[model samples]
Target: MRCKYPIYLLLSLIVLSCQRKDQVVKRDNEPDIHILQGEDTEMNTAIENAQKSLYKFKEAIESRNPDYYNFALKERFNTAGSGGEHIWISEVQYSDDKFYGIVDGDPISTTEVKLGDTIEINPHNITDWIYIDKNIVKGGYTTRVLRKRMSQKEREQMDKENGFTIENE
Candidate 1:
């Protein structure tokens, strides 16, 4: 039984070591800084690629042809996320008319709507700009919180300097 205990412990350590080695390395060019800090330097390199095929989807509201973002939303989804993640475009039938169609991605996911505010269905509004960024953050794009921590005192001073104030507390 004593020998069995040490053997069991040894097997556990081996399994753990294997898992550590097999961890999916997420980056190719840069050593993911959060995982292996300061191991690789940043590089700015541009790679050219043509856009992906766009699939037309149901538009919730009619905005004419070009104004509808169903094409671009699919394109953004293809570019930003793992392709198999099942992206779909949805047109919000608005009783409160803020936005019409949204790529089923973050930033778009929570942004509010306003009545009579029609989206012209252009690429700028349709693009899931936060999609890649939100996904990469692991804990879902709480970078704003980190920024608050990093800039709290500086921001507070700036607010005071700029005549922005908190009166009571």
Candidate 2:
């Protein structure tokens, strides 16, 4: 996804576990962005966990809880040929058993959508969900996995730049 500041800043923070060597991209004007491999076991597990606990995000939205803010979902969009990239959609709304949200960042590998575009979310394509609670991040399973791959300095920089702390649970 296209990297921006603040919330979308996290969109570019992708890394694989140290056990595996993943391609890491360094930009002069942006944070290091890593491309995750689909075969990674840890990432797969994170996605599974995120899907299993998706109800929490849905419930929070349904309740209209003020404390729960910045609700988003990461969904995989297919490329023209094969494979797909997971992009985050923010300002999510659920109604009639369907989800709708705005694309939070620009596409890196897929041309199906772009930043700020409203689109219907397919439940099966959802890989992760997140919301902020009292300045702490909740249900960012994939994000946590990616963060674990960063160095201590990188993690600290991310925490400082993102304006939210993701606690280790």
Candidate 3:
């Protein structure tokens, strides 16, 4: 099945901006981009942690807490020769061992999917999951890692833009 969303790019863009200290220009609504190495141990560990704690996200969703909003999941999509990208899906629902959500961002690599497309995802493919509760970020394991990579100023800006606070873990 084909998947879509450039949410990974959006996150990476934030991280990249911090690392490079470069101004991001959004031309024609194009997403700012960042590329991470496959062997980045920290990032890999973050993904693993997110998968391990996925049950918590599922439980929260099942609980139907009104405070929980902006639920999103990240999945890896493989292309023919360009490897794969980790993209985010929003408005997620989980049932019968499957996930349904809309692509939350425009893809930077794969063409099989695009923003606002509905897709089914296997749990094994989920690299990350997140939701907001009371203007605070929860279940954003990868996001925490990304935040750790940012400077204080950049982190503050990111938090302000997202309208959520990601406390230290």
Candidate models: Cα lDDT each = 0.23, 0.77, 0.68
Which candidate would rank higher by TM-score, 1 or 2? 2
What lDDT would candidate 3 get against the real structure?
0.68
Cα lDDT tens digits, model 3, 1-169, are 1121322332443222112222343547555544566566787798899999999889888888887766788887765565666677887997786789987667766787787899997688788888777766677776776667769997777665655665455
Q: What is the per-residue lDDT of model 2 for residues 63-163, given as tens digits with 9 covering 90 to 100?
A: 88777777889888887556677788987899999899998756666788898899999999998998777777888888888788779998898878887
TM-score of each: 0.17, 0.86, 0.80
In terms of TM-score, which candidate is strongest? 2
Flag the better candidate by TM-score, 2 or 3: 2
| Candidate 1 worst ten-residue window by lDDT | 43-52
Lowest lDDT 10-residue stretch of candidate 3 = 14-23
Clashing pairs in 1: 97-114, 97-115, 98-114
Q: What lDDT score goes with residue 29 in model 2?
A: 65
